[model samples]
Target chain A: MLKIEGLRVELPGFALQDIHLEIANGDYFVLVGPSASGKTVLLETIAGMHRVSTGHIWLDQRDITGLEPERRQLGMVYQDCALFPHLSVAENIAFGLKVRGRPPSDIARQQERLVRLLDIGPLLARRTTRLSGGERQKVALARALMTDPEVLLLDEPLGALDPQTRENVREEIIKLHTELGLTIIHVTHDFEEAVAMGQNIAVIGAGAIRQVGPADEIFRHPDSEFVARFTMAVNVFPGRTEVGPAGTSTFVVADARLLTRSTVEGPCWAAIRPDSIQLVATSSEAGPDNRFTGQISRIINKGSVVEVTVDLPPAMTCLLTRHGFDQLDLAVGRPVCLVVPPAAVHLFQD
Target chain B: MSKHPGSQLRGKSRGGGQSLNWVFTLLGMLILLFILVPLFKMVFLSNKQALGQALLDPQTLSSIGLTIYAALIATAIGFVLGVPLAYLFARREFPGKGILEGLIDLPIVVPHSAAGIALLFVFGSNFLVGRGFKAVGIQFIDSLAGIVIAMLFVSVPILITSAKESFRKVDVRLEKVARTLGASPWQAFARVTFPLAWRSILAGSLMMWARGMSEFGAVIILAYHPTVAPILVYQRFETYGLAQAIPVAAIMIMISALVFIGVQTLLRRRDAGA
Candidate 1:
């Protein structure tokens, strides 16, 4: 288990304040945030590169806050794959073992294991400067894991690859995690990647973690406006909530009102995912509950799904499957009615 | 189509370009000749029989040997002290770092004779450092140690500046990665940083060694006895005139050029193999 309590690090023009986190052994956790959000700093601090201004870090019930990186027994792979250019791929992988003064036979055994596991057997004799981006990433991963560190910290590991290569490396990481039962902490700014690979995630913004929960919980229900916006929740509005008839909740934004099933009262913010709003023809006999009439302002084909922008009192974006869009024959400037179920709306107290 | 616009422009511009190219070629040849003419004249003017006799002379051989040996020792000393200081300056940022870097290059700009005079005051027989060394049974004046000290004082800045450039080219992230992968700070530097920067450091050592071999002003002031090749050449010129001095100078020049070319070729071949 790894635990960080009240960790604070101060760098130039950036600071991480009072960060608290806990990860169980063998869990795949991701730290997600926007650019320059201090994600990389936090990872480096955990790897013992940066000293904490305040707080303690505990690894496996031992306080390792003061240990050097070598003594901490943690491995880190940088975003740029900082491999030693002068060494061949085999030498690069064998570096850690050689530095630790392991016997030659033991070093060779571990090197062979990693080379086979990462499928880099053919690249062992090649120089590091000649490897492609994806090849370098594999070599870096092999080098990091050769030491059998307790926790492997990866900083944007797949952020530099093309789309097809990204998918391949992502699957490779997941396979390695399960096969080796390794505890991994991956950091990235892409939410889809987090949802795909992480069992639990911590959403960081402006140098602070706003929420930490399971992947589905973080995606479906965010705790703040900032978290909602960062997670691609398109329709978020600040409103005041009042108890309504039939045990429902009424949220009022400037001239618009939305009904929700949430029992929270007083001023609040409400958010709904773009895919949750359904669009129907204006003449459809939909119920009056949570229904609004609007004109379609724009329609965009987004490969797998079509995005339709509706101009209600406040503009809203809705996502539809290509088949659904073709069935409706949607076009710009067409009149439409939006159906938002009460259960789909999430309300958070301001 | 009959008169292509691109073809016409190329034809008109080609004539003007040829004259401009000729002017640059003439200027380049002038600079080249200026360097080569003196060397050719010296080699051709010296009588071959006299040059061979000078090469076989005992005094001449010992003087040339002492000069090369002292310069080699100076280069070794420079490498031992300058490499670590260069690495430190490249990796750390502290108050007055820029001023300290400028101070390292000061010896290069100072006049060599004036530099020898400054060293005389500090390491002369009567000075504190000189007395301290004398207590340990080592003398500097009129000794090989004095010649080496003079050469090192003037030539070490080249090594430091060149090593610093090589260290700067190495990425700090590579060292960090090594540290995280179970290597200590020293291990990372020895295995990664030093190997990556070795070529530049070797080139710098060559420059310092060559510069030390050619030093005359400082070595002459510090240690005039146990004459080096340059001092012997000066003495011959004064006593026997240009005829004797010409042959000795030509022999010295040939030896230095041969050594320089041989070492450079070995380094280039090693680089290609690596």
Candidate 2:
């Protein structure tokens, strides 16, 4: 297990304030944030490159905050695949082990195991300069894993590869995760990578983590407007609480209002993923549900889905599959109805 | 149809621009020949019979041997000290890095005689550094040791700048990765930076060595007693005119050229090892 309590670091544009996180022994944690949001700094700090201004990092119940990188037994793979150009692939994989004073006999066996496991057996004798991008990234990964580090940190591990290569590398990482069950902290600005790799996701912004939970929970229920906007929740608006039957709820701006899902009664903001919104043709629809009348302002093609930006009474935008859009024959100025259930509304303190 | 417009223009411009390339090429070759022909002439016109006698002469062989030995010593001194300084200059960005870099390049830009004079002042009997070293029973004036120091003064910049350029060409990310991979700072540098930049560093050392071997003005100014090869050549020229001096000059040229080519080939092999 790895835990950081009240982590703080001062950076040029941002300051990490009272940040906290926990990762189980085998959990794959993803730290997602915008560029220059101190994401890399935070990783480097945990890696022992940056000294924390305040806080303690506990690994497996031992405080290793003051330990150097080598002593901390933490492995890091950079975005650029920092392989030593002078060393052969085999030597690079054996570097950490040899540095730790491991016997040469033991190192040879370990190196062979890692080389075969990473599928870099053919590249063992080859110099690092000859490896492809994916090949280099694998070698870097294998090198880091050879040390048997307590936690493996990946900084945009697949950010440099082409689209097709990224998919293959992503699968390789997933396999590594399943086999090793290593505590992993992967950082990237990419949302899809977060969904694919992270069991737990921390939505970070500026410096502080705005929200943290299971990947599905954080996406289905963000804690702030920043996260909602970052996660492509395009239907956020200024809201207020009003008493209703049984209890109270929040309302979004349009000529119409939205139903609140939570019971906490205060002025709060709400976010809903684009896919949560359901759209239908306006045909005197009289259903016992949340609905809003609108005219389709535009139909934006987004690969497999068509995002319909509408000028409703509430001025809403919702995402629908291409099949749905084609069935509805969505066009500009076409009248439509939007339905958002209470369960889809995510509310946070204003 | 565009029927090779470029080819047509090429034909039209043949009389004017075509001759321009030929003219420049001839000028460049003339510059090359003008520089090299005299060197070739020195060897061709050398009296091998007299040179045989001169080679047997104690004074002549001693001077040539002194030149070769002094260059070896100067190269050793620079290799020991200049390389680390160059590496630091290339990698670090301290407050005074620019000033230090300028100081290293100053010797390369200054004339050899001026450098000899500067060294004389600093390592002279009365100056602080000179006095301090003299107190330790070391001296740098009119001695074989002085010749080595003077040669080093003129050629140290070549080694520093070349080694620094090689170090700078190596990516810093490689070093950072080594750190994360559990190698301490020294281990990281020895295993990575030094090896990768080894070829360029060797090339630079050879350049400085050759520069030191050919140095004349500095040796004359600082240490005229222990005559080096160039000083002997100068002495023969002044006394017996060009005939006697030409053979010694030819000998110096042949030896330095062979060493330069050998070093270049060795460096190429080192690069291939990478």
Candidate 3:
């Protein structure tokens, strides 16, 4: 287990404040954030590159806050895979073991195992500078793993690869994690990657962590407006909530009424995922939930899904499957009824 | 539409193209001839027998050997001291860093005679450093150590500046990765940073060695007895005039050219292999 308590790092023009996190052993944690959000700084601090202004890092019942990077036993892979260009693939993979003064036979054994595992046997003699992006990343991973570090810190490992290569490497990382049972902390900006790989996700923005929870819960029920928007929650609005009967609340947002499960009153923010808002024709209105009629103002086709914007009192965006969109024959200026279930509307105190 | 401005310029120049080409060629040839003429004249005027005699002379041969040896020692010292300082300057930020960098290049702009005088005050037999060395039975005045120190004082800036540039080209992230891979700071520098920057460091050493070989003013002030090649040439010129001095000077030039070509070829081969 690794724990960070009250971690704060100050850099010029940026600062990470009051970061508290706990990762169980063998857990796959993903840190998701926007660009320039201090994600990399936090990762580097954890890897012992930056000194924390105030914090204590505990790893497996030991306080390692003051340990040097090499003594900390944490391996890191950068986005660019900072491999030693002067060394060939085999030498690069053997670097960590050599640095630790491991026996030559042991180093050779580990090198061979990693080469076979990563399927980089043919590249053993090739210079690191000559490897492709994917090949370089694999060698970097192999090099980092050669020392058997307790935890692996990956800083946007797939951020530098094309789509096809990214998918392949993502699977490779998952396979390695399962086979080795090593604790992994991956940082990325893509929401899909976070959901696909992260068991638990931490959303960071503006030098502070907005929320941390299971990937599904954080995506479906965000705790703040920032988290909701960052997680692709398209229909978020500032509103006033009124406590109705029996612990139910009605939110008045831009002259539209939305029923939510929360009983909080006064000013608040209400959000619903784009995929949660249902579109129906005006003539076939469903049972009364929280329904509003509006004209379809825009239809944006995004490959597998279509994004539809509704011109209600306050415009709301909804994502629909291509088949659903085709069935409804949706077009610009068509009047439609948007049905948002009360349970799907998440309320946050503003 | 009005004629394009670019076409107008081209049209204006069209009539003068032939004369412009001739003028350019003439000026280019003039600069080439200015470099080639003196070199050709020196070789042509030196008697073949005198050239052979100068090459075989024990005094001339020893002087040339001493010059190369002292320069090599100075370059070695520069490599030992300057490389770390260059890497430090490249990777760290501190107060007065800019001024310190400027000071590294100060030796190049100062007059060599003045530089020699400055060295005399600090490294002379009576000075603190010289006396300290003398207590250990080592002498700087009129010694090979004095010659090397003089050469090093005048030529070390080339090594430091070139090394700093090379270190700058190496990404700091590579060193960080090495450190995270169970390597200590010293190990990271030795394993990753030094190898990556070796080519530039070698180039800088070559330049400093060449500069030290050609150094005359400072070495003459500090140690005149050792009789490096340049001082020997000056002595020959003073005693026997241009006729005797020409052959020795030509020999020195030829030696320097050969070494320069050899180093260039080695660097080319290394680059190709890499």
Which residue pairs does candidate 2 place in steric collision? A254-A314
Q: Which predicted model would earn the best TM-score?
A: 3
Identify the runs in model 3 with alpha carbons over 4 angstroms from their true place: A245-247, A281-288, A326-334, B1-47, B266-273
Question: Judged by DockQ, which candidate is best?
Answer: 3
Q: Kindly provide the TM-score of model 2 when superposed on the true structure, using C-alpha atoms.
A: 0.87
Candidate 2 is graded, for docking, as medium
Best by lDDT: 3
Which is superior by DockQ, 1 or 2?
Answer: 1
Task: Tell me the TM-score of model 3.
Answer: 0.90
Q: Taking the tens digit of each residue's C-alpha lDDT, what string does model 1 give over A1-350?
A: 99999999987789999999999889999999999998999999999988799998999998988899989888899888999989999999999999999999999999999988999999999999899988998999999999999999999999999998888889888988999899999999999899899999999988888899999998988889988998888899888897866677887776567888877799888888989999997555435487877789988899989999888767878999999998998889898989888887899964
- Give lDDT tens digits, candidate 2, residues A1-350: 88999999875556788889988999999999989777887888888776688999999998978887767888889998888877889888898988778999989888888777788899989998898889989999999998888899999999999998898889888888888888889999987789878999998888888888999887887778888888878888767656678675746555656776766456777787778888888664634366777788887899899889878655678988888888887789878888888788777774
The positional error of residue B248 in candidate 2, measured at the CA in angstroms, is 3.6
lDDT of 2 by residue, B148-214 (tens): 8998989989999989998998887677667777878887788889988888888888888888989
Give the total clashing residue pairs for model 2: 1
RMSD (Cα, Å) for all candidates, in order, is 3.5, 3.9, 3.8
**Colliding pairs, model 1:** none
